[model samples]
Target: MENNKGKSEWVSQQNYSESQSTPYCITRRYGSLTFEETVQNVKNGIKKLGLDLVGEFDVREYLSSDMEKMPRHLILMVCEKETALKLISNDIQMSVLFPCNVTIKEVENNTIIEVSIEDTDSTWSSAKKKEIIEVAKNTKNILKKLLDTIEQQNVKL
Candidate 1:
C-alpha cells in the first residue's frame, strides 16, 4: 500500500484457509519514530487503555548476545483482565492464546508494529467461538488505535 507521501506503506493482511492454521499477523510502519520511542508509546497506550502488560521480550538483545545478526525487536504481551476472564470462562483451552502479542521492530529506517490477530477459527463450540471472536476483535481494535495514535503524534513532530 502507498501512503500519502507515495512511500510503500508497511501494512500486511493475510487470508488463511480452513486447512491452514496460521493466524493473521498485521504489521504497520511508523516512519517518524525510533525503535525506543515506538516501544515507549506502545506501553503508554496499553496503560491508557486499561490493559495489563504481561511482559516484554527483547528478542534482538537475546539473539545478539549469542552473536547473531538481527534488527532491534521487542515483543509485548498485553491483555484486558475482564476480556481474558470471559474467554477463559467460555473455554479453558483458550488460555493458550491468552495475553495478545504486540511487536516493535526496526525495519530499514522505520519502526514497525506487529500484532497477531487472534484465531477464532478453532474447533470449539459455537458459544466459545463467539466469545473468542469478540475478545479478539476488541484486542485488534486496541492495538490498531495505539498504532494510529503513534503515527499521528509522530507526523506532528
Candidate 2:
C-alpha cells in the first residue's frame, strides 16, 4: 500500500496491537483516497462484494460535540446472511460477533486514509465445531477480498 508519495506505508497485516478486549482480528491497508473518498469506497466495495452493509457510524462527528476538530473516522457494519446463519447454527454463542466491521480512518493529521477490516477468524477461536471454523474461515476470506477491492479502487492518484 503506497501513500501519495509513492512510499510504501503498509506497516502490518496482522493484529499486532491486539489486547484481550480487542481480540477481533484486524488488518489495515493504506490507499490513495482521502477520508471522504475512502469512506464511500468502503460502502461501494462492500456492496460490490455482495456483503450486507447493515450499519454505519461517523465516529468523528459523534465525538466532535465534546472535542475539537477531529480527523474523519467511520465504521461500516457488514455481514452475510448465509454466513451469519452458518456461524450461529454451529454455535449460538457466536451471535455476539455478528455483523463484522469495516473501519475507514483518517490519520497523519488527516492527510492519509487507512481502511481496516475486522475479520471473523480468531475472534471466536474457542469454537470446537467444524462448521463454526469453516464459517469463520469463509467470512475472513470474504472480508479480505473486500479490503483488496477497497485498496485497488483508486489505483492512480
Candidate 3:
C-alpha cells in the first residue's frame, strides 16, 4: 500500500488477489499505473530479478478487425535460469511450464494495471515433491518481489 516514497499512493484502487486452477496457476496484483508504464516496469523487473526475457507477445497485435480495439494485453515470458535447470532436472515433463508468464493488461478502460504471474505452486502441490517445492517457492517469492518493484516505481497523477 506504500508508494515509491513510502507513502500511500493508490491503495484505494489497488486490489491484491490470487487465483488458481487445477494444473495452471495465476498470481495477480493490481495497480494504478498506466498500461504502458506497467509494461515497461514489468520488463525492467524481469531483468532486475535475474530472469531471462525469452520474449514478449503482444496480444493486441493479433487483432486485424474490430478486435484491434480491445484492451491492451501483453505477455512476457521470463525464465529463471536456476529455476528452469532445477525443474527439468527433477522431471523433463516440467518443461511444458517453462518460462513463467507475466501478463500486463489494462482493465476498466485503462484505469487499472493488472499484472498476472504464473505461479508454479500447483505443479508441486499435488506431487508434494520437496525439491520442486523449494524451487517453486523461491520462484514465487521472486515474482512477488517483481510485483512490489513495479509498485514502488511510481508516478504522480
TM-scores, all models, native as reference? 0.70, 0.77, 0.75
Clashes of 2: 0
Please give, for residues 28-73, the per-residue lDDT of candidate 2 as tens digits: 6464677777777778888898999999888867766544546677
On the 0 to 100 scale, the lDDT of residue 97 in model 1 is 74
Write one digit per residue (lDDT tens) for candidate 3, span 77-150: 98977888998898777788778888887665467777878776754555467888888888878887888788
- Clashing pairs in model 2, backbone N/Cα/C closer than 3 A: none
> What TM-score would candidate 2 get against the native?
0.77
Among all windows of 10 consecutive residues in model 1, the one with the lowest summed lDDT is 10-19
For this target, which candidate reaches the highest lDDT against the unseen true structure? 2
- Winner by TM-score: 2
Q: Tens digits of per-residue lDDT for model 1 on 1-157?
A: 5224332222212121221234455556655677777777788878887888999888767655343336667888887888878888888877777677777765543334333333333312344477677766666677667666665545553
Which ten-residue region of model 2 has the weakest summed lDDT?
Answer: 11-20
lDDT-better candidate, 1 vs 2: 2
Candidate order by decreasing TM-score: 2, 3, 1
User: Each candidate: how many clashes?
Assistant: 0, 0, 0
